[model samples]
Target chain A: MTDRQDRKAFFRELGKYSALGLEMALSVVIGMGIGYYLDRWLGTGPWLTIVWIGLGFAAGVRSLYRAAVRSGKDLERDEERRRKPGGP
Target chain B: MRKAILVLLAVAALPATALAAGGHGFSWFMMLPGGERLFYMYAAVFIAVFLLVAAAVVVGGKKTEEMVIPDPRFTLRNLFELILGFLQQLAEDIIGHHYKKYLPLLGTCFLFILFMNLIGLIPGFLPPTQKMNVTLGLALVIFLSTHYFGLRENGIAYLKHFLGPVWWMAPIMLPIEIISHLARPMSLSLRLFGNITGDHAVVAGFMALIPVVVPSVFMGLGVFVSFMQAFIFTVLSMIYISGAVTHAEEH
Candidate 1:
């Protein structure tokens, strides 16, 4: 990557990585909150909570996987940029 | 130089250890009740920053020719220009071709959050971003704007991403997408709130322990943290906006 592109990419990557842990944790909390509300409204005791928490965990892992894939692609791009020293 | 840094780090670590022990002593204006305190604090900071920006603009606007020529010395106008220039570059790189349209929002977020965070470094003034409501409010605005721009760009197709690639996967993908989307704002708010509150608390704790030289190190750290948190928030917002606006082309 060119110097400017490299800096930009570094900032973007930093933001993405920093947010990942908090995002995953919140994903679970949001899922639980949604599940709890649905359970309360429908008078289903624990079933919805169970299901939603499961869904939330899945969502958390899914996002982590997506970020992993993105970083992998980014690394590949960086490698390509390195191979062609002068090209942007 | 290494020994000096190590001593600085050791001084910094003392306060952090104090932070862990959980004794903080800092007071703001005691007139307001607990619930409305953050609101008033945020408003005061908002007005102060607004006035500062307005003054800078008015002064800078007075001489149109001078605006073109760079200032010989560091000045408020130069600082503002530097920040805006950096944000412009960031927007261009992250948001791509239509980056100009989003510069105003990104710039506002950067400046507002940066000022709010910086205010915490001053003794007796708490940063509003330390409050959950303030940070969450800011995050929600970014959240709403991201979707609004996405909808404007892609119409109804923007919602289709939530439904996954295949029709059969919609049930699974929809909830996961919703959870993840909701998490973005929550995480944004939480990270800002936690960092500022923690930083402020550490500074306060150190101030209570020893009034003189010790607190300054943590205050310096506070300054760095404030800039970092603000930058991270803006960068994330830019990433989100770019993702929303450009997702259509990729998928």
Candidate 2:
């Protein structure tokens, strides 16, 4: 039972981050989209576009970092649990 | 085995015959504007599922001596019970203790998306999920609800995470956070739309080329794709909502 539960948890965590690549790509696209619209609205040629695109790339990296941190913590917790007395 | 193959061939031929009869044109309903068509299809699917569930409830509730023994055969009530139980378990696992409040949203999303995808497998029906507008609309609902739950659960503290760890990093972190949040809906909708559309196209393409015993293989693959996509959408939505509502310090 414990073995099966571990497999289930493994799959759940796998599914959680399966779309990280797409999310990162869309972050950049959405950032550029927002930048383009803002430039049109305020008549600020290309400057805000550059700034927002950079922001979007930063956003993608941030999300990737967050996912890594989360999974790292999960691994640590799992290790701690496994090392406990009578743990499977 | 021979009889089963014959039936499968006949079922596969039905779509072609229907199209030929319709003069190779789409059904009247398909001619409606995209938004209107989506609305009508959703209403139709919603009502059909609601009626089926209501019937299942009524039938399953009947008092009987055999009720003491669990039914071995698959039944409508059993199907729903299985799905609900799965969702409940998923919520409890992901969202922790306060999971019940969100079950309604999660359950509806799973069932609705599953049925919507299954409908596309029929000879003449189109799945709304194959369209960007429909999937985006659903994704937006998830996005908005995540924020709503976050605000309700954590109040002012919810916005603190958006700001960042310290005062100096606010300017840099704020835009990144907003972009990340906006990307959630974009990613969700695009993934579902692309998967369904590609699956549908593959099935249709194979059906046109072979039109024999082979399309069934693709059709089987389509069913798996549909279920997998729905499951993925539900899993991601749960994770997002969990992230939103849970206290940041716990992470």
Candidate 3:
């Protein structure tokens, strides 16, 4: 039972970090697609596509930044644990 | 754009299921988005869901007493309490004190998904979540519900949440928000589909090659994957709901 819980915790950690990369890629693709569709519907050539790409790119960056900062905090916490006197 | 992503994701996610069906579902058939009618995967999913709901209803919420020998079927109340207790702890841990309001949604998502994920582990049955439509449908529900709750909580100002912080960033933030939102369903669908398909395929392959020996090991992994995927999905949904409903000041 304890082993199963341990494994679940391990996989839970794995899923969260792995999802970060996926979020980065899909966000841009989604943005570009939305932009392209809007441009096609409006008969406005590449303008909307260009605008949508920028938004997508920004959103992707924002998400990545948050993940990076979060993981960094996690690292900082680990470091604190290590540096604490009498820490195992 | 979504149609293209949906096809690409569906195809990419379930090549293993195709191999299991001896070359169907996951191949060029998926290119025809609504072509799910050709497979019984959807029906299997509904059956699984129906069974789960019916059982939970029948079981009701009986309180558990200590049992000398704990069997899942024999100790129904114990099973219910264990699952409900775990889910409550998970909800409070992830979504905080306000978790009570969101408990029903999260609990249903977890239980239904856990059921769907487990069905494939039963031989001769294909899980609904193995299909693009099933996972996509779930992703859409989470997406819509989170936004619905968010809007209900924040009113018209909810629209401004997409505008982002600086007034000048509105034009940039809007499309980005839309793209990010679009990506959620894509990511959710693809993740569940790929994980379940991969697990089921490994078990099938082992069962074919060496009977139940190697397959049992992988089946153990399948059980882990089944529970973990459901947990991840529920947690992500909770995070989304909480984020949407949070005050602008917190943002």
Place model 3 in a CAPRI quality band. acceptable
Residue B153, candidate 1: alpha-carbon lDDT: 97
Better of 2 and 3 by DockQ: 2
lDDT of 3 by residue, B1-251 (tens): 99999888767745443454443233233344564564445554466668577677645574456334455564655665677778787566445577898888888888888888886776545667777888888899999999998888899988997877799988777766777777777888788889998887777776556552466698899999999898888867875776688745456
Better of 2 and 3 by lDDT: 2
Per-residue C-alpha lDDT of model 2 across residues B42-145, encoded as one tens digit per residue: 54455457757765674766777755565578877678778888778878877888899999898888888888888777765667787787889889999999
Ordering by TM-score: 2, 1, 3
- When summed lDDT is taken over every stretch of 10 residues in candidate 2 chain B, the lowest stretch is B20-29
Residue B88 in candidate 3 has what lDDT?
82
Candidate 1 lDDT, B70-164, residue by residue in tens: 87898777788888999898788667778999998888888888888887665545677777888899999999999999999999999999898
What lDDT would each prediction earn against the true structure? 0.82, 0.80, 0.72
TM-score of chain A of each: 0.86, 0.89, 0.68
- Backbone clash pairs in model 2 (N, Cα, C under 3 Å; residues 3+ apart or in different chains), count: 0
Q: What lDDT tens digits, residue by residue, belong to model 2 across residues A30-76?
A: 89999999999999999999999999999998888877876787677
The alpha-carbon deviation from the true structure for residue B16 of candidate 1, after best TM-score superposition, in angstroms, is 22
* Chain B: TM-scores of all predictions: 0.83, 0.82, 0.75
